[model samples]
Target: MSLIDQVLARAAADPGVRGVILTGSRARGTQTARSDFDVTVVVAEQARPWRHSTRTGTLDEVVCTVEALADTSVHWRRYSFRGAKVLLDRLSGGIAELVDRQATLTAEEAVPLARANLDAYINQLYRCVKSRRDGLADAALLDEQESLPWLLETVFALHGRLRPYNKYLRWELENFPLPDPWSVVLMPDQVRLAPLCLFPAVESLARRRGHADVLDGWGSDIELIRAFAGAAGP
Candidate 1:
């Protein structure tokens, strides 16, 4: 039997273990030669914290109680738990449900988040444009870099999804392309060349999604930024 099978068999024999979940690169099928098995072992709320590992460090085990698992913050664990796989669930599917909850974002949660990220992203883009107008190339580049994460967060929240980790961003986009015009500009290569390529699409999406107020908050400044960015094509 493989090491994973042996580990699962042992976990099955432990009465305290409520479930076993496979996570990290191995679970996402993005592992490299150096990747290890990332496992989460769930137990009763009263159970003491513990861990398990192999001598060669091929396995990384984390032990948590049901209460702790449920209490985990979505912001902190969302990317980590995304695409997780349940190897065993003695809770009759409760564990699987928890994993799903950790991976998802409801519309109610997404809307306000999208607004906030859009505000931040536009703020950075405006700064980038102003710096360029002033001939401050270094400052403009810094502002451009600063805006990327916010831009990504805004896009993901618009779709009620989590912003993936940078390492997985390309993989996620390739597997699940965004809607229409947004998809083309977000490709890794395109983004590397010029992230501003998505500005027009993002602006349209934000306006259609009831974020016109946020954009309007910037007034004519945004129009100038848009014009300047367009003129400065990738």
Candidate 2:
């Protein structure tokens, strides 16, 4: 068996470990030579704190522990080390289920920051459209252009204190970026860009709500942003 498989087998020896999840590029099967394994160790109790440890191997290894298996509210133990594989999930108890959610735990932004992000994305869209209309048809708003909806969703999420995951949103909502007119070219049939690109929109969208009813509020700003973004003509 491979080294990854062996490690997973070893982890299974412990009865307390409930599951193991492999995320990042490897779980997506897009791992490169430089990619390392990210494993979450799920245990039966959250109150148990952990000390870190390193073990020798062809792969760099580290282990952390946390508890309360099968509980929804407790966060899992996170282990990240350099190695290109799934070492093991050997919990004699059972296999830990994997939950793939992004934007899992973000606090909402303040009103000022949210407003700034909204204005910034709208203004960026306007600049691109204005430039294209001015005949720089080749100009595109390439930066911070893809985070529009998730940003907006932050407000929507804050109505309930949930961090809406963009990856999951893509599966459900046909959302737009903090869109510029050039978004058509940069994001034709795509959802979610780099977190860096989505940064401002994420901050602003949540901030606009400012602890208000995000769903029931903020319609005007959303409309205004859309109008500015869509002004580019064919």
Candidate 3:
């Protein structure tokens, strides 16, 4: 009947299927007529053919030529079918449930890691920002500084072996979740990320035992960045 209905129907019949979770723009309901459906189907083991397929245009419903239940393909109609079609799945394990579970960094788990990352990067951010204020007659310094939040978030995400994502901090926090002891009420401001500047963020982290300076000891991190720009810039 519906694309989702057809897909769900197929998934129910499959046994190897472990879990299936819808993702990307489609699941979020922000999809336009041209958006593709992104569903992650999990199986007991990696399906070789599906994993190896190099088809450039699709990820929604590619069927493995060899691994029967392993066949996967995109509904291909979000671009053409509108809301009138149903996409099916053939996951053999509970992987979809695993995805639905999403990752969570509870207060205890995330606070320490976040604080550590913050401390390690704080002085670095200050130096870089200060350096930009001091030596950046060139406009590119501003651009580089602007990109620092992304870098900081990346470090924070990686500091705890966390998942990597972009500016969608709130969505990431609520859906995927993280340990944020201080900001119990507000969403993580990707913009505020700059102001957080790691100094205060890691204040708690530095005082604790066994914590490493995840980003410390590289004061010229900005200079290193500038080195790249100086080498690349015109």
Candidate 4:
């Protein structure tokens, strides 16, 4: 049997291991030649934490209980499992289903998250510009660092999509992009260029969603940034 098959077979026979899931690049069909296998072993609530093992050269194992996996607050873990490949599921199939469900954002969750991220982006953008105006170059750079992620998250949540981890951002964009305008914001590398691309993208999204109120909250600041960014040029 192959190494992966042997590992799954062993996990299936273990009374303590209730389920086995394969995650990371291999599961996503994006693995490079150097990539290793990542596996999560789910145990019962009362069981001891199963030891993480790397006995096989290319396999890395993580152990957690169903309770931990079910906690939506553990977003990173949930995101990790969202695209997981089930190996052995002797736990009534609930683990696999839970992972799949958590991958998606409901309107209820997305709307508030979008608003919060939008507000945060505006706040950071304001600080960035203000710092530059005051000749605090270092402070402006720091604010720029803080602003981009919030801006990206805002756009993703507005579209009822989860913002992927930094490592997967390119993959997510290539596979499942947002509607036009917003899509180009992430393409640029310069901080000045970001606002130039992002402003119209956000405006387009707001107009499309009939969320005029969302843009209204930061309308003036956005315009000010847009003017400055426009003068800065590509």
lDDT (Cα, tens digit) per residue for candidate 1, span 1-234: 986798799889989889989998999999999998888888885546444544355888888888767764548567778889999999999999888887888788899889999999999999988998899999988988888989889998998888888888777787778787666776666775564656887888888888999999998999877987788675
Model number with the top TM-score: 1
Worst 10 residues of 1 by lDDT: 47-56
Each model's lDDT comes to: 0.83, 0.41, 0.43, 0.72
Once fitted onto the true fold, the runs of candidate 4 whose alpha carbons sit more than 4 angstroms away are 47-57, 182-184, 187-196, 207-215, 218-223, 232-234
Per-residue error (Å), model 2, residue 53:
4.1
Q: Candidate 4's residue-wise lDDT over 5-117, tens digit each?
A: 88788887878777888888898888998888988888885555445756455889878787766666644555676467988777678878766766877798888888887
Off by over 4 Å in 1: 46-57
Per-candidate TM equals 0.89, 0.42, 0.49, 0.81
How high a TM-score does candidate 3 get?
0.49
Candidate 3 lDDT over 1-234, as tens digits, reads 766566566666776555444556675555677666555444455536345322234347543322322222231211111111123334333333223223333345445655545543554454455555567645534544554554444344334434334423455456545456422322545434333333333334333533444444445563454344344332
The residue-by-residue lDDT of candidate 2 on 1-234, one tens digit each, is 975676577668767655554544465454578766555555544444432233333344433443332333442221121111333445532333223222133343234334444454444544544554466655544433534543443333433323223332332232333234223322424433332333334334444545334322545544543443434212
Error of 4 at 51 (Å): 8.1
Candidate 4: how large is its RMSD? 3.3
Q: Which pairs in model 1 have colliding backbones?
A: none
Q: How many pairs of residues collide in each model?
A: 0, 17, 33, 0
